[model samples]
Target: MGVATTWHGTTILGVLRDGVVAVAGDGQVTAGDVVLKHRARKIRPLFDGHVVAGFAGAVADALTLFDKFEQHLKAWDGDLRRAAVELAREWRTDRYLRRLEAQLLVGDPGQLLLLSGEGDVIEPDDGVAAIGTGGPYAAAAARALLRHTGLTAPQIARAAMQVAADLCIYTNDQVTLITVPPERQEYEADDR
Candidate 1:
């Protein structure tokens, strides 16, 4: 058998604070030890921009999953939790989806969830979740920032991504952040 190609690079983080939810992702895609691309956008606004989602793993696989998730969102009338659960169930059971190697972090105004191909839909108790090679570092930094500072959700997500980039060779400094503001509240403008 031929050697398996390992896809690496990417750090995705989600943080919910003060009624706002933010998801951030670093822009680096690597194949084995070689860097293939920079400025890859792994974070996307879904369901008419009512939710933000980010992914880590093979780019094609993640994109496929994103499309599937959006369909579920539409079917569920933009209910994030239901859409996430349905996606997780299908991802675990469907033959093609079961083979996908990717993880998703999705967030809306009221919820933040991590979905896996293993039939897992996890909602973090601390309102922070992360995935990919630098996930742990990002999660730790975000937790500290959430506890010690009054920064907004977007700020915490960006800062935590920066920390992960600084520590993980697989992650880069270029980040894309998307946020879903609290229900009935206007979206906050930030310098991107």
Candidate 2:
């Protein structure tokens, strides 16, 4: 389902704390090299159970992948990481799907992840991570927060958002977050 679609701007970030895991993304939609829309939601709740997904590519592909991923997760006894890797493998193996590139992050209570084209699921320690356009800035800020101040999950998320916003114009209305309790495999999206 694609003639051409460049109106895809998104970011995905994840952090693993001692007891909780948090993630965030920016909201911007662009076509090719032009900004087509602002305040687009890149992060979304897939199953409303406990896991969240952030995509950065064809919106259609994102939707399709997410649905399939959800189905697989449900059938697999809620294995978030394994499910995410399977999603990436499917995307990479399927020729048409390979074209609609997307990045995804799946997290549970004690783990946070970054999923990409090569089917990489990177778990950043020191609990700092980010993706999309403002990824670098957010990651940097997360590192600073982790190093300089002992902040909670919310504080780290806010700091990452602020830093990302300062570095990228798209982040002003794009800061989004989700958290999972240490003992849980699902997550809750933060409204603030």
Candidate 3:
């Protein structure tokens, strides 16, 4: 709110399959035509490990929204849908929050949702969601993998992020993934 934060360049993807959910994010940040950071983490657990969220946009703005959403989660008693909806509503209508340039992909074991400043809280029909520069590619890849491959949710998420990193200039192979329906554990692809 004090100073406008720079836009964060990266990719984040989420997948839900067979009662499990996984989220992955690339670790690259760029400014203008120059790369700034190579290991920024964009996905995190919230509400006492019940929900996982990945964000794309200004890092400060995203963190602010994340903190607010955490409060919403607490207020809603860890209800993912309610917390997401309330965050979206506030982001859409609140004077300051409406200016945040960020999009959120949040989920639990059974649900994946996308929240935006436009007051949209969407549940992906195919249990796949993505945000950031490489979002479309990752989402499409995950959808295809879900439809045609026997990969688990975590596998699909990691693969999709890898696919995104290959195609999107802003995205990279330094991916961080987390799975739900079991306890959260971090997974990284090859570390290249």
- Leading candidate by lDDT: 1
Count of backbone collisions in candidate 1: 0
Q: Which tens-of-lDDT digit does each residue in 17-77 have in candidate 3?
A: 9888899999898986778788888998887778899899987899999999999999999
Candidate 1 on 85-112: residue-level lDDT in tens?
9999999999999999999999998999
Q: Write the per-residue lDDT of candidate 2 for residues 20-113, one digit (tens) a residue.
A: 7776666666667677665656666555647766666667777777787898788777788778778778777877767766677677666667
TM per prediction? 0.92, 0.80, 0.92
Runs of candidate 3 with Cα error greater than 4 angstroms are 1-8, 187-192
The residue-level lDDT of candidate 2 at 130 comes to 74
How far residue 55's Cα lies from its native spot in candidate 2, in Å, is: 1.8
The Cα error of candidate 3 at residue 14, in Å, is 0.6
